[model samples]
Target: MQHFLNSSFTIPAERNEQLESLLKIHCHVFPYPAKTKFLEYGDAMDGVYYVFQGRTKHYILAEDGAEKILYCLSSGWFFGETPLTLHEPTGLISETMEPSILWKIPYSVYDKLLDVNKLFRTAIMNCMSRKMLIMRHEIENQVFNPCKQRILQLLCSTVDNASLVEGKWYNLSSHYTQYEISTIIGSARVTTSKLINELCNEGFIRILNRKLQVSKIIYEEITDQMDLL
Candidate 1:
């Protein structure tokens, strides 16, 4: 309900009311502090975690102890479902990117909602389908694209919803470190840094106050390359 924060589609008010009613009984909402781990690898998926506010990253710990970021989530996405649905240990770590309000709803409640709420089920399915598509694109980026292209794609995805001012995209940075970005794009930190500098010199992107703004020309160029891909 109320567009469910980061969701692309808005749920009908009635369906939202139904969901909220259940949440009142079965969900415990609380503020999770910044830099905290919401869930960790091998943790049991006892409930679904929802983002009422703030951002989070879902990552996996590499064998070498580096973090391999799977994706960043903001405001609307649900996590902890993998272990919940499959009855396996969590494969990823969910950490708060900032201070966040989270809802933890028990599996029993989730099951009850699914049994009785058609709209909620549909919304979950839609979200899952979109996530699957994102996974496919990520695989393609890792396997076929060069590091620069991969980084570009990653940046574009991060800023897709950023506000535009005078035809430039803004508020795309500060959410991640270069190393974290390198991990997500399957590149080295040094390489990512160098590429970022190159882009800056070329006037493709601008960084100010730790935020990134993509020039319209650069945006079009990236889109063109993506189309060709």
Candidate 2:
């Protein structure tokens, strides 16, 4: 599927190495186990975080205690900048999805680097711009698209290119639970489950060994339809 909006900013290899070198010099590196809660709504943040390895989920809890997943940050991604820049408590909750190695750069050091290093500053700006674009697309999807479409788009976007089977079935990079899918699409778990069954019945998607896979033909067809809208 065309995933212009779902794609995150990936730093070029050389630049990424440079970033890691810089972080190693100025940041505190630590390991976090899976399901670790880094911060919650209204919690104070000490500094910005860089995902040296593994992934994290960032979301907000609603009044009804429903989780609304904003996005997932994988290796090479940095977060916690918004609250630091604004000098305010975080509104979103962040948790590591798996065992992770993170680099924490204190706010003062982060600020100083931005002021003194043009490459670092430009990279941060590019990352922020990509995030804003993704957020805009998510808002538009929630307001205008149906839950089924959203779910399909999300699944298609996660297709693992390296695992494509006979050039038809595309394996998903991650096996997402129904509850997780529901939160991401802002739908109830039951609704998401029902729609997922519908997709399976229609030969669009299937689960094998608890891992989701999408049909390439169906993916292209759905994305083509979306392109016309």
Task: Please list the C-alpha lDDT of all candidates, in the order they appear.
Answer: 0.67, 0.81
Which ten contiguous residues of candidate 2 have the minimum total lDDT?
A: 5-14
Predicted structure 2: lDDT: 0.81
True-structure RMSD, every candidate: 5.3, 2.6
What is the clash count for each candidate, in the order shown? 0, 0
lDDT of 2 by residue, 64-129 (tens): 899988888778777888888889999899998889998999988989999999877876777677
Pairs of colliding residues, candidate 1:
none
Q: List the residue pairs that clash in candidate 2.
A: none
TM-score list, all predictions: 0.83, 0.91
In model 1, what is the error at residue 164, expressed in angstroms? Answer: 4.0
**Could you give candidate 1's per-residue lDDT for residues 12-44 as a string of tens digits?**
112255555556677889788888986776888
